[model samples]
Every structure is written in C-alpha cells, then in structure tokens.
Target: MGRILDQPYDVNLQVTAVLSKLSLLPHPHLHEYLLDPYISLAPGCRSLFSVIVRVVGDLMLRIHRIPEFTPKLLLVRKRLLGLEPEGINIDHVTLLEGVIVLEEFCKELAAIAFVKYHAAASSSP
Candidate 1:
C-alpha cells in the first residue's frame, strides 16, 4: 500500500466525512476500521494520521457533544499514534494519561454547555 502522506488530504477528508457523525450511532461492532491502516504505517506518517484523527474527533465533539464518546475517540488517537501497549514506550504512558485527562476536561465542558444552553433554555418561559 502507498504511504499515508501520499494522499493525506483525500484520506483525511474521506475519513472525516465517514466518522464525524459516528458518535451519534450505537457503538460500532468493529471500531476504527479506517484507522487500522495508519497504525501500521511508517513513523513519518504518524503525525499525518494524528492530524486526521484530531480533525475527526473535533468534528464529533463539536457536532454531537456526547461526553460518552470522548474516551473512545481518544483511544483511537492513542492506537493510531502507536501509544497502545504493542507500540507504547514507558515515556508515553504519561502522554496517554495526559490525553485521558484532556478527555475528562472535554466531558466537563460538554456538561457545562448542557447546563448553560439546554437547561437554561428549557427553564425559560
């Protein structure tokens, strides 16, 4: 197969389009199918895959505000970036924990938005 950078934009666009609204669906039976390829790519492609995942995650977060999906999305991030057990280094553990904390932060923001937007709107006359 060709390298990720060879067609980064197209791949990013396609993956983003397919996955952006995935959080709205039930948990997929096979998760991150599109991402499997990136994990096995050369190290140089990792950064490009990271960007692709970030874009997809951002789109999901912004559009859905489903706090439950945060961790799953980050897991995909960790996997695609080789931060999972098979590829993980001791030094990367802290990085993984930092990301989990960031996911918690995003969930808190979503909760805040629900209270400020949905709850407030519903309470109004």
Candidate 2:
C-alpha cells in the first residue's frame, strides 16, 4: 500500500471510484433532499462529495471495526491539505491537524487489525 503523499494520483482516483460506487448504493438521497442542484452543479459539489465520502467512510469503518478504510482516510487528509490556503489561517491549520490525527489513529487501528488477523491465522488449526 502507498502512503497518501507517495501516491496522490492513485489515492484520489481510488477515492473517487469508491465514492462513485457508493453513490449507486441504496440509501436516503442526500443530494436530492438537502442540496440544490444549481449549487451542487458547481465546483463546490466536488468538494462536498469528497468531504461526505471521507466522513461516511470513516464512520462506517469505525462502526464495523474495519481496517481497510485507513487508506481512504489518508486520501481525505490529502484532499484537505490541498484545500488549505497560502496564508495559513489558525482555524484551517487546526482543522488540518485534526485530520492528520484522525489519519494516524486510523493507521494505528489498521496495524492492530493486522496483528489480530495474523494471530488468529497462526493459532487456527
């Protein structure tokens, strides 16, 4: 697996693909209900989609105890980094740091999952 900064193009492409797939899944239609198509038609829609996918993916991973979503979280962190401005507002820096913390936490969870999985495999008959 590649680090978020190491393979940004691949990460963004994968995240976009996953989100596109998720959009097809059956669920309450958030875009239709909450977002106006006119507003959503602009570049803001892509930013909104990225945020939604990142958040939903993180919550699902945590709820299900799945480690595979670590990379997705990293991808989101990368996206947030790109959105940061040159002047570096304190609030923005704090938010970016929060995202980094979340990514690191996810990585730790993934490491634990790897260890558990290996232990279980080794102990199995």
Tell me each candidate's TM-score: 0.29, 0.32
Model 2 worst lDDT run, 10 consecutive residues: 30-39
Specify the highest-TM-score model's number.
2
Off by over 4 Å in 2: 1-91
The residue pairs in collision within model 1 are none
- Model 1, 87: alpha-carbon shift in Å? 17
In TM-score terms, candidate 1 sits at 0.29
Task: Give the C-alpha miss distance for residue 110 in model 2, angstroms.
Answer: 0.7
Deviation (Å) of 96 in candidate 2: 0.8
Could you give candidate 1's per-residue lDDT for residues 1-103 as a string of tens digits? Answer: 1122233434534543444344223343222332222345555544323654564465444435434455655664666567865443332333334344444
